[model samples]
Target: MILELKEVHGYYDKSHILNGVTLSVGQGTSVCLLGRNGVGKSTTMKTIMGMLNPKEHCKTEGSMKFDGKELAGMKSHSIARLGIAYVPQGRHIFPTLSTEENLKVAARAGVDGSCKWNLETVYTFFPRLEERKDSKGDKLSGGEKQMLAVARGLMQNPKMMLLDEITEGLAPIIVDQLASMVQNLVAEGVTILIAEQNVKFAMKVSSDCYILERGAIVHHQATKELTAETRKKYLGL
Candidate 1:
């Protein structure tokens, strides 16, 4: 497994969010955490990224391991340095910078300097970004912003990516495009762990699926095993 969380709990001030969430992402496969709003799906992503300090953003306890290395208490930057990249919930990008500059700022040499996601490589995978290379982040559309976020994360040349809410408040057409991009990334050997609400899109791209409810995992099964009955039972679509 590239990423593993065992009985992990996260808290926000006095309100606990993630209650003993446990899941794993195998190498070269995609895993999806599905749930409605405020179910700790985003919290789970933050916990794994080391963005949540103990009892601060959340009380982070339990094991978050990547490649068998401990990550619970490590600094967020340290975690990023360990071949882990994160695309946050809001698709936050450098609003003042051009698309090219945003990607450039996120460029990292990687731990071994063998990373493969350079500007031309990222551009090849996301042609929209290439066309909008000179546009400032604020000038781009929502879909473009999301693409930039993913591309910037790729620029880090991570071994695994933690993507939160990849398809939120976008046109269905844009969502479809993003889904294809995700599929292509996985086909090219990118390991992805996604927190998403779009069930069909999630199931289509993920190999494994986990259902989160009220900050806890309520159900889990392979993506292929998710039936209409099961999805309705857990997610009430």
Candidate 2:
């Protein structure tokens, strides 16, 4: 497995969020974490990225292993350096920075010290971003912002990407485009773990799916194995 979370637990202030959540993602494959709102889908991504620090009374426990190394106590930057990129929800782009600058600021070699994801290469992959290279982050459309967020993460040349709700609040056309982009990423051997509410898009991108409910995994199966009955039961689809 490229990533593994074993019996993980977390708290936000005094509220316990993740409850013994356990899951794994194989290298070079795409996986989905599916759930309804407030079911700890985003929390799982944050926990994996080491973003749920002890501050704000946020505490996490249990094992998070990446590429054979423990990530339970590691800092977020340290985890990033270990080749895990997180494209968080909300598409947190730098409002004042130009699109190109946002991508440049995040530019870094992979953990293996390979600079395969430079601006030119990334621009080639995301030509829309190149066209908006000079535009400020705030001026971009919602879909463009989302693309930039994913592109920024790619700047790190990560081995695995933790994508949290990448398709939220977008037009159907934009959603379809993003689905193709994710497919291309997977084709290029980038491991992806996406947390999503759009079951159709999630199933299209991921080979395997993990259903999360009330902060814990309720089911794990191949995407094809996810039936309508299961979706209606856990995801309320």
TM-score of 1: 0.97
Q: Report residue 3 deviation for candidate 2 (angstroms).
A: 0.4
Cα lDDT of model 2 by residue, 1-237, tens digit: 999999999889889999999999999999999999999999999998888888767999999999999999889999999999999999999999999999999999998899988999899989999999999999999999999999999999999999999999999999999999999999989999999999999989999999998999999999978999999999888
What TM-score, over all chains together, does every model reach?
A: 0.97, 0.99
Best by TM-score: 2
- lDDT per residue for candidate 1 within 114-164, as digits (tens), equals 668999999989988999999999999999999999999999988889989
Candidate 2 local lDDT, residue 171: 98
Number of clashes in every candidate structure? Answer: 3, 0
